[model samples]
Target chain A: MERTAFQIDARDNVATALTELAPGPVRLAGDGEAEQVEAVEPIPRGHKLAVKFIAEGADVVKYGVPIGVATADIMPGSWVHLHVMRSAYDERSAHLNLRTGAPEDTRYE
Target chain B: MSRKEIPSLEELRALRWRGYAREGGGIGVRNCVLVIYTVKCAEFVARGIVEGCQSPDVQLVGFDGCTDSQCAVNLLAGLIRHPNVGAVLAVGLGCEYVQPERLAEIAARAGKPARWLFIQNEGGTLPAVERGTAWARELLDELRNTPRVPMGLSDLTVGAECGGSDFTSGLAGNVAVGRFFDLLVDSGGTAIFEEIVEAVGLDWLLLSRAANDRARAELRHAYDKMIAYCRSVGQFSVSPGNFAGGLSTIEEKSMGAIAKSGSRPIQGVVKISVPPPEPGLWLLDSTPDPNPVQYGITNPNDSEGLMDLISCGAHVVLLVTGRGSVIGSPVAPCLKITGNAETFRRMSGDLDFDASPSLTGELRQDEVARLLAELIAETAAGKPTKAEALGHREFHIPYKYQEKEARRADCERR
Candidate 1:
């Protein structure tokens, strides 16, 4: 497949999206390139892009350690977010709610 | 890292300071009194005590939980010993998952005199609040009696990070942070950086910097898994802000963002909620999927991520900003350094330190390092950070999900 959007280092698994793309409608270049791979999620701008088919129940690699896992089956060019990649701490985690500067140490003090 | 050949105070004016920026260990800029809670039920009482206290150094921080034994155990164990806390006051409800006395015992073990207050046992909220307030006041007075002992710069650990990032983050703020990291490392002081997501496309560079083949391979495997998992759901990990800021690809962002490490060799990697086991140079495994439940949510912004390091015991934080960040952690001092000269000019009052000199080409690398080292020394002795002075306390407590399947996965990772 011809690399489109984000380019992946030959040594890395993740690709950076060069352009914003809708799920299941974009064409790309490479061995696994698809004209419209079913998008598991809406890929945000400047985030990681999948170069090939990634299985669910697997680790999400960025710098190489697992960031999170795929909650469901995804195709090429889908946007990934809270719905697909679930977090353990959803309610008090600062990542979900942008406001409220409460500290993560939830002990009562 | 060697101690200053000969120490002198006048170096403060010459921008040449003795006992500043030692190599290996990261130095702290502030010594804080951490007021902690042991469980959810005691939160209000703890807050009342903190609010009524007269000491400006005490910071209120805690966790929330009812009876989940495991959760309470983790929160209490982590918060009480977090490095940012110089003195600790652990509050709890008598019947909470974690006992307040147990927390006090733990703190006492660490050689920090811990005061305990139980809301339920102490005659409910009002009585507990009254007693806790009076006790905290006494503790503050006791803490003040301890003289400020001069410590070496190498005795400090300063965490470096950036969030709410823009394109300039890599070019300006992050780079400055890297420079500061390098200077600290050379001096035998420790400077740690995290945010694995920012390393999406820079695996090769990180692998090369890895201390051993195991870490190098681990680095590659970790990034690959993140990408695969993200792609499995058909969603891109990139954000719109990155595109708007003119980043064409994740690789571009990764390369720029990783530069904040300032050419330091990777010592080792640590998991979330884990403090750097040993100082030197450490790469905290900060890669988190966009999921709120699996990965932590408290660290949405870069400063928040830095706060994690602070919890692990960083005495100070070098917060780099390209756009602008006014927030700061309560326990530790945050030295806000801006890469964008325009942003620095506009938010001069909100900023504690400026690295705009690098952008102007007027200051060389060593000169900036010398200036930053001086700032670190002064702040360490006892100076209020920009965030503290402005009362910019931004807190976000992450909520743990109860999905059976997800919980299983989380358990496996742990």
Candidate 2:
């Protein structure tokens, strides 16, 4: 199988896109096993693609660690990014809300 | 990833490089003559003096603040007495809080040639530059004769930092550095990593690598302090560049950033500007102490972070950049590594090591690590890094509000 995305660790549900992937079937490989995942959208290089289905509020695993939680239900091959996920540690999400004039949250404090 | 074959411990101990032996039993890879400005007002005159001398060994460094902060003073003193420096020429405007004479005294106490000139007292810029140039030339001549010693890996204190990172940084560049750090620690050498803000979500991961219960608690405290400091400043470690480079959140960045520590048991955590007590993998808690209000956030720029590492007695800093950054430090040499093959190709002249092979699977992590160790040996033996050859000495000291001053400011505001 031609590798289109890279799963950094065996436990990672999100694999990094190795190249600019158009909407198509992408083969992800790691730890001696290969899996076929479809790209639901155009994914740029260095961006993450969901290799496993993640329910809303579930953790997005990468590097064998939980990076953050999904804000929306993310299906396999969907782009895993700020639009569907947010940082678990930083509650403010100030960067995302800057343009929307969203009220600042004190949850981080 | 599995560990690759490494040199035997006995063979590792045999690795040696010629370095300048400092008076205080320290080995320096580069014998630099530093022209330090006490305040920003004197920076121009200091640069003029260094330019007039026209010596690669003579470099410029300084603090930009006019008011005295003990932190600033301590950091400046450390750089002046750094092993890499053989002599120092301190320049001041005379009215600033930092005294040029005092800085020169630090160098003198270290048995290094030291001189001071106040721009105000020397009849302004031209005269100060003339005197400073002559003094720098003399210092350089004297430094040329500094005794060289054969130093082993155990004698080194290496610092690792990542800037302008992308996803490949963790998978390639930082991981390669982590492997190098593992070898360094295994060889009884000291290794340090900083930027606690980037370790926010990965505190537990770092804690798990602590050498003991005490080290674990210390790591936790550092992480807590970093979180509080960031919250106070209403900022996070993630930048627009970071997001564009494929990092979606601080947690993602933290996971990648912590990879530079490798899998070694962290001996302990030390405060900023304090060297590690023993040889092992250590973390430098660069967060400001006492939790001062109105104090700015940490890491104003990559150079400041590198400077902080240097203040902790790092002989050389391994800077991993996936998005590309061209920077260096005056007190410690910088070896820039890049994981992005395109970035390496575009900025090959500025970067030092290409760890892109790890990304392409052409070389295993440990193989790249071995290559990095060889590069470090070459650098310590006087091979100039790209930054050094190109003369990129970017230094900055961020403003830090003292705890007492912050308290007073709060009272006044109320």
All candidates: interface RMSD: 10.5, 4.5
Candidate 2 lDDT over residue span A1-109, tens digit each: 2548888888888998878888899977554144778899888788899988999999999999899999999998888887888887776563454223233443666
Off by over 4 Å in 1: A1-109, B1-29, B39-41, B67-79, B82-84, B221-225, B228-239, B287-298, B399-414
TM-score of chain B of 1: 0.81
Q: After superposition, how far is residue A56 of candidate 1 from its true place, in Å?
A: 30
Candidate models: Cα lDDT each: 0.57, 0.83
What TM-score does the predicted chain A of each candidate obtain versus native chain A? 0.48, 0.78
> lDDT at B223 for candidate 2?
80
Q: Tens digits of per-residue lDDT for model 1 on B305-342?
A: 66556655667777777667788776667788776666
Deviation in Å, model 2, residue B21 alpha carbon:
0.9
Clashes of 1: 86
Residue-level lDDT tens digits of model 2 in B369-394 = 88788778778888889999999989
Q: Which residue runs of candidate 2 sit more than 4 Å off their true CA positions?
A: A1-3, A92-109, B1-13, B401-414
Worst 10 residues of 1 chain B by lDDT: B16-25
